[model samples]
Target: MDGSQGRKTRQVVAAIAAGGKVGRQKDLLACGHSEWSLRQAVKAGMIMRIAPGYYALPDADPLDLHLARHQARKTCFSKAAELGLWILNPVPQPHVAAAHGRPVPGCKVHRVKGGQTLMDILRQCVGCGSELEALAVLESAVVLKQCTVHELRTAFSRRGDGAARAVIAMIDPQSQSIVETAARYLLKKVGYNVQGQASVWGVGHLDLLVEGILGVELDGEKYHNTPEGWAEDLRRDNLLVINGVWKLRIPAAVVLYNPDLMLLWVERALDRIETASPR
Candidate 1:
């Protein structure tokens, strides 16, 4: 490619990369690339025409190409998962947001304007999923500092967002992971006063403190499988016992999948603590 042609190619490449490695023909044209330049670039294998109006790098993500073809962007659970949020259940198909376009086959479509924000995704999540699922995503965003509780509450304060606002009220940013959020939500729903990341004198922060006595620690194997992690947890458990705090250590999976069993255990432990203490 000559100097002028090379500059044009670089411009097109930069445009596509800027658009998450996928650009529409009109977008490239708006970026000062002519039809002749685009055609030449495609012919020279500089960029691939994934769809009629879409141009992407040859190795662009298939999902991006698919979304580009349908003029949609990820939203709801799909976008939540993409943003590394805590997703309790995985959807079978991608969920996308689009204002006006033919629905992408095998994908959930949420009618939303172009250039949707993280708040938009959260609003869509609240509208689309169950309360628990929505809470998980919201808590994930808050804990990650992606958004704030105030921002969310304000965003959902509009008319017709009563349900979304209700879900936003349930967000606990202190719940570190999805498992902790689920456990806390379940406990709260059953009328337990659940406190997340409650600090004890010696134990620092417990995953949850129910009724001010029972320390429920949700342990994911990823963090506890190592010998050092196991020893540290044991040390914390010992400190809790010394401080008159009863500890209930449950696997993260139990909180996610077998919540009933976890609840039963909690009830039983609380009962034991109550029975043993002189009321």
Candidate 2:
């Protein structure tokens, strides 16, 4: 390529690195990459042409590629999960904010915040997700220090009572994981006195303690996969039992996928613990 073309290509690359997306006529022109230079970069495999006017880096995230190709911005459930915030349900489709007519299938569509602000994305999440789901995202965000409880409360105040109020009232920044957050939500929703990250004398920290009687463990797959971890978990459970803390270990999958069944098991365990208690 010529020196001029090289300079333009460098400009294009900088733009992509800054915004993760490059638009042909718009961004290329703004970034000093002419149509020919854009073509040269594409031909040289320096960048990928996603849609008619959009370009992505060769190694861009597939989801972002899809977003650029579809001319949409990720928001709500999609953004929350992508940001590593806790959410109760798995996103069935990427939630996107787009111009009124542009809709991506297998993704929820919102007409608000087509190119969103951080607050706009979070507020949209509060509006889009269910009460429990919203709470999970908010709690995770606060715990991760991405957003503060005061910021969330302010955002909720702007939106008025309903989902935001519901979420803010129950948000727990101390909850460890999405699974742990979901378990707490479930137990709370069912009117159980659930305390998260409760310390037990012999077993370290229980995932949750319900009514100060039943100990609950929410085991993630990664932690329980190895033999050493499995044995350690067994040892912990045995110690808890020996200490007379009636406990139930629930898998993360059951917590995420089959919360009702998990709850039923908890209720049954509680019943057994209650009955077995000295009168």
Candidate 3:
């Protein structure tokens, strides 16, 4: 292939490999495209933005997703340099953050030397790059068997940046179902605070709780679909309501696809609960 064509091929390859998740920027640079080229590709719809500087080609096959993830990783490094936050996810760091030019004051922001950043994280990590390290830390914690949402909540003080809040908002507790996860994120997205797998006095483990009003149930096939499961679900649900708990049981499918309808349902539940409690 010609030089220009060969370069285009590499850029495309990187985006595919990222699984719409992560990638390498130096490879794109090696392909003869500058950072601007990657940005242009995103603007031109040649690829989708995964994070701040990362891009993805979509999920079609190995060839497609692989390149996407690879390209996203490169952007992670570039974004790290631009934002001055070192990423510690995707891979571990050798040195400290203060060594890499990160600001160190009351808190030491250890720069992991750019392995994963938000802009280079999952192919749709929108928001500022400043919290990219935090995202990496969170993702890594999960992979390393460190509970993500809990870790972020504890041992965590905001870094006095807007991006920190965004990352925290986007992070959700470990969910058993993507539908339930999406439901919680969307609910939070719309301004309704929610907690996952919460324990209610009567219901034991609920799929989701909107602070105090709404109850969303992700109907996992093993638990909520079978006849025996259904019988028990009814039992628990009845107990919740009879005990003066105002709630609505939403299926996993509705939570994932028809979220607007779910939100509407949430509004009604909230009104009912608010009227009952008045607090």
Taken over the whole model, the C-alpha lDDT of each candidate is 0.88, 0.80, 0.54
In the order shown, what is each candidate's alpha-carbon RMSD?
2.2, 3.3, 13.5
Q: Could you give candidate 1's per-residue lDDT for residues 8-115 as a string of tens digits? A: 887888788887788888767877889888887898898998778888998888888889788876788998898898899999889988778568888988888657
Query: Lowest summed-lDDT stretch of 10 residues in model 1?
Result: 108-117
Evaluate residue 17 in candidate 3 and report its C-alpha lDDT on the 0 to 100 scale: 58
Query: What lDDT tens digits, residue by residue, belong to model 3 across residues 75-128?
Result: 333333333332433233222222245443323233344444342232222232
Error of 3 at 141 (Å): 7.0
lDDT of 2 by residue, 40-74 (tens): 78888888888888887888887787777777767
Q: Which prediction has more favorable TM-score, 1 or 2?
A: 1
Strongest candidate by lDDT:
1
For model 3, the superposed segments whose C-alpha errors exceed 4 Å read: 1-165, 275-279
Model 1 regions lying over 4 Å from their true place = 3-8, 27-37
Per-candidate TM-score against the hidden true structure: 0.91, 0.82, 0.46
